[model samples]
Target: MLFRLSVIIVVMIALVLSSTWSVNVQAQGGDEPEECVEFIQQVLTDLGTNCAGGDPFQGCASHPVITLDIDEEETDAYTDDYLGLWPIAEDALEPEERAELDPRDRFPLLPAAQVDASRFDLANEEWGIAKLKVSLPHYPVAADQVEDTVFLAVGARIEDTTTPSDAYFPAAPIDISTTAETALREAPRANADVLDTAPSGVALAVDGISPDGEWARVLFTTNRLGIWDLAWVPTSVLDPTVDTSDLPEVEQDSRVPWQEIFLHDGYEESDECSLAPPSLLLLIGPDEDTAVEFWTNELYVKVRGATLFMIPPSGNVLMAYVAAGVLLVDPDTTDEWVIPAGFWGYWCLSEPDFYGGRVPPEPDEERERVIVPCADGAEFVRRLPDDDMQAWLAALLNPLGEEVPDIVETSGIGGPTIDLSFNNSDAIDPVRDACELGQLPPDICDLYEFPS
Candidate 1:
């Protein structure tokens, strides 16, 4: 057809013009002839493929990882105004001189990382376009190398990550009773504006305790502001493990949200117990934030409120070898120990539910009160003595092939579930009628038993 003939004529004209331009540029001998040839070849290739399809240069430049050394001596050329690519001299030169030429002189050095180019020059074809900008990684900048104009390609893939070693211990829970009435204030001082009154037995998140052990920064949700806020409260109301004198000062403006506290829905403002669930009650252990000054390495159970410090025995040279393997701390420096997630190498205990069962029975409100029925498969918190705990720690650190003693069982808090039933029948006297009627038959008394 006539349309097919017209397309052939247009292609021939483009090739003729490219040939003419290439010969004139080669005669001048300014830049590399191959660069011009390659550019033309690429244009023809794109026209054959992309143009034949639809978009000419769709998604071509977005994937190559390119790096370049900045021409520091030519810093004057790279002002804020000249963000676009500039030309470099390509006259007859030695290898050293060629190295000195700026990379932008040969080809444009696009920065895809630091800047958002999705809707800018990359998307528009009015400007001389090669390929998609976002298809490639960010251009590298070597600020420490040559001070003169130097062209160097050194691309590196940088990934942002937070490892267990680099994780920070942001805040700890305040061990205060629900009955203790304390005011959370806007400032660290007593006369500051009162934000909210925290009732006792509700474990609140504490950022830092004051040096004198008189005040501490605690987080609370204020009804007045209708937002989560950090405020100061008296230290006397909190049950802490370490001396307040050792705690670092918390900057009033630099407070971050405690993730665990923000996600916790176990306790409300009116709850009697400090914890959210009865299952979590058994996880109550030592307060880790308070022990930072004395212990170098510690294992913290965030939800269970337990922290077990790794304190290896001294005086023996072999102890160091053992300590090195287990302890993630360095006593020489002031670095605090941080417990990673899912490290269940410590003793734990859970408080019994409201009705007396497998665990040490709950207190009787009155002698006249009737005993509640026990659930099908009741479980109690596995406890170990102080000596047993020390022995377990010693066995872990001991280089010698000592027989490991099974002292404490690991907690089943976050582990596999178990049904607390005896032959599929309720084991306790007060089987809540609601659970008894359920299809799965709730194991009200069963608990998770972690491996020791």
Candidate 2:
């Protein structure tokens, strides 16, 4: 709690220090915020911009990391405390020209990766330490096989707070609709279970599409079950007018790992942050039906083309499967409980300590940190509120270069989890009685009406 407060204090202080923090936009001749003014007035301190030691494509040198395909070889991009990332020009600019640069050019969202609230008084944002975000035409990986589908990364958009436990494929919105009555299925194939039948005009929101573009992952709230589900529906139902150009094509049988394994190596000495929470890596599979399995925090997990939020053992390890995704949380290695996306599942690694046992109260301040096993202190599963999910997604998709907040926690929302916690995985599935694999019975499924 204190850790979160401290970060808030840092930003509040920055906003307080900034003269034009409240200004709608910075107008020429108008007084800008101190942070913005200092960005240009003082030597650029952003780690991403400097040549000595900073993020990719240093302001004064050729590309140190991946060679960008951008028009400008060397571009100047810095972060300000108040305003997010400020991209000026490639070459040196005259003071007048610098002043002429529109303040709106700067991004508004900041990353949670390199959060430092203690020194909000510091000069620039991305203080030479923020993780680099870059676009790689062909990202080189350690392994040999690589394709455009790999999204093959060079740097950390999918990285996490602790070592090793990080990464996932990018996720785009699914606010598309159906032109005619659609059949939601259990899998991408025609023989799959018919989960539900939607009306002709029914609009649907889904995430990824099948590799062959024949299927889409759709979420539906069944009336019989009175629960939301993660199921597959044919792409043919999509409204012709809905623009799905932005949708990322799902890679069937993905070669990419949905998430990296946890090293079990605890936080470092320099990583102590009173209580600033570690960021959770929430992901939907890049593939279609095949489930991706991996090891982390002494637990084995299974997930198909579903949305799962994982905080590896390195940092208060939390594995939560949300809304319309299925995540298998198996600690004992037993036949895992199939945690239905009907209700979100939270598997705990640590009980009292939220941030992987870090930032416990002041009395335990001197205690040594260790990787808390998921079975030890974890409660297995808990329900997460809707607001928490929204805040997290916003940070992940922040247009300001994916501003991942170090702590994407919701405060003042009563609490993180409600009083209800699932006893077993079977208990978590709301439709098991009336529906099997989202296959609805005519007697129960057809009775209720869904929103358009």
| Best model per TM-score | 2
lDDT of candidates 1 onward, in order: 0.26, 0.34
| CA lDDT, candidate 1, residue 33 | 40
> Per-residue lDDT for 60-86 in model 1, tens only?
111122222233334344443443222
Report the number of the highest-lDDT candidate: 2
Write one digit per residue (lDDT tens) for candidate 2, span 1-452.
21222122222222212222221212133323545434322212222232232222112211112111211211222213212222434332321121221211221111111111111222323111122222111111212221211111111123222211111233434556677877787778889778688887776766567768888876565442232345677888887676666555653332122223332223221132222223332233322233344444444565432333444434444445332234555512343444444233444454325443443333232223222211222333222223433342333233222211122234336654212222223322333433454443343322222111
TM agreement with the true structure for every prediction:
0.22, 0.32
